[model samples]
Target: MALSHASLSLISMIFLAGSIVMLFFVILSGVTSTSPLSQTYFLRADTHGISGARAISQWTYFRICGDGNTDCSASYADPPVGYAWDGNPNNAPAELAGGHGGDTTSSSYFFMWRFGWVFYLIGLFFEVLTFGSGFLALCSRLGSAVSGLLSLISLVFLTVGVSLMTATFVKMRNAFVADGRDASVGTYAFGFSWGAWTALLISTILFCIGRHSNKADVPSSGRRWGRRSRSTRSHRSYEGRRVKEEYP
Candidate 1:
């Protein structure tokens, strides 16, 4: 079925809204341990007997929580991997326990998490901009082009963020398992993170398609007008010839 400009705009808006909502949930994961919402976390593991570490630790974007997010520490941006162990090198996993004196986490782990967190925020910012520009898509191809550009930017940021987040946590989980501790990934967090990226991708493609479709319509309409004008001119010439014949 062919989609009109209005239909494409509306669908794109819907997908963009969904992506925004999913990203919000991912960001807010460990704010509280309230029912299903608390299930949203990147990684969870048993860290029993570790100094300054919770018996059950759940890591989110802002804060690290305990016992399925029931108890959370103060929230902050770009939370360090060492936050899980109170920055105690002795309490953290071997891979994360930095060699330098007084260092709680390895340089790789620290920077990976920090960059991932920053990227998430950047992606969200661009997504908001795209949403704002998307409103004009119904009326103008320029608007669709702008929205598509913004969405593409958002997608790049999100793709990097999600990849880093996944790698950091997957390695963390493996480290915990190797240390004879139980660890697992949070299903809700995994789903939402990737889901948001998928939605934004679809929205971006739709915007681009809408812009091209509108552009195609213009030339077709012009061609139709050209044909109509030629036909009208021919009819007039034929009528003049008939009049001249009758008079002569």
Candidate 2:
């Protein structure tokens, strides 16, 4: 019932690959789009029918008659266009308006968002280490003890990083609520990015199981073969002793 090192290595590699893919989704959903950390609302406009505000952490944008009469749905983009961010609340605000440190109202949310990325980057480093360890395990190039140790360390880093990202999700949700936006409705709710987190968590668990597999003799065949060899040696020794006794 022992798991083979080869199998463990294979599984580890799969999990590591999945982790990397999930990290990409996390980045795309978080950095590229405005889900899990952004919200939009309607504001009264003097010149237009309504001004729109989309706030993600400290980055806020106002749009003059962008989507007031329409469905109020807008696309997310880098240096998001078609939005005013003058902070007027009644009119569109200036474009690209906000400090990197986040505004005073939602500074903590921004901090958490940035902090989560830091954790992810650190975790990526550990994941790379795990990749090397898994490769060594597969090739029998390293001792079992060393490979297992490295895997354990990598798992710890990955877990911490993913956990921090979970915290970011929570903070973002809270920020949505603080702005009087209903997080339960529409895109304000958790989306594909959240699903990525779930996938990441499952991958972590799989990696742990795979790492444990490496600690054993593997496939049970090796153990059986060893026992068979020992038994054969014992039988030969017995026969030799009997022949000597009879001859004497």
Top candidate, metric lDDT: 1
Tell me the TM-score of each prediction against the true structure: 0.88, 0.50
TM-score quality measure for candidate 2 = 0.50
Per-model clash counts, in order, read: 0, 6
Give candidate 1 regions above 4 Å deviation: 99-102, 215-248
Show pairs that collide, candidate 2: 62-84, 84-93, 85-93, 85-94, 86-93, 86-94
lDDT of 1 by residue, 4-54 (tens): 765787799899999999999999888766755688989999887777888
* 148 Cα displacement, candidate 1 (Å): 0.4
lDDT of 1: 0.86
Writing each residue's lDDT as its tens digit, candidate 2 over 138-157 gives 65534334555555565565
* Deviation of model 2 at 170, angstroms: 3.1
Candidate 2: count of backbone clashes, pairs at least 3 residues apart or interchain? 6
lDDT of 2 at 12: 53
Q: Least accurate stretch of 10 residues (summed lDDT) in model 2?
A: 57-66
Off by over 4 Å in 2: 30-105, 141-151, 184-248
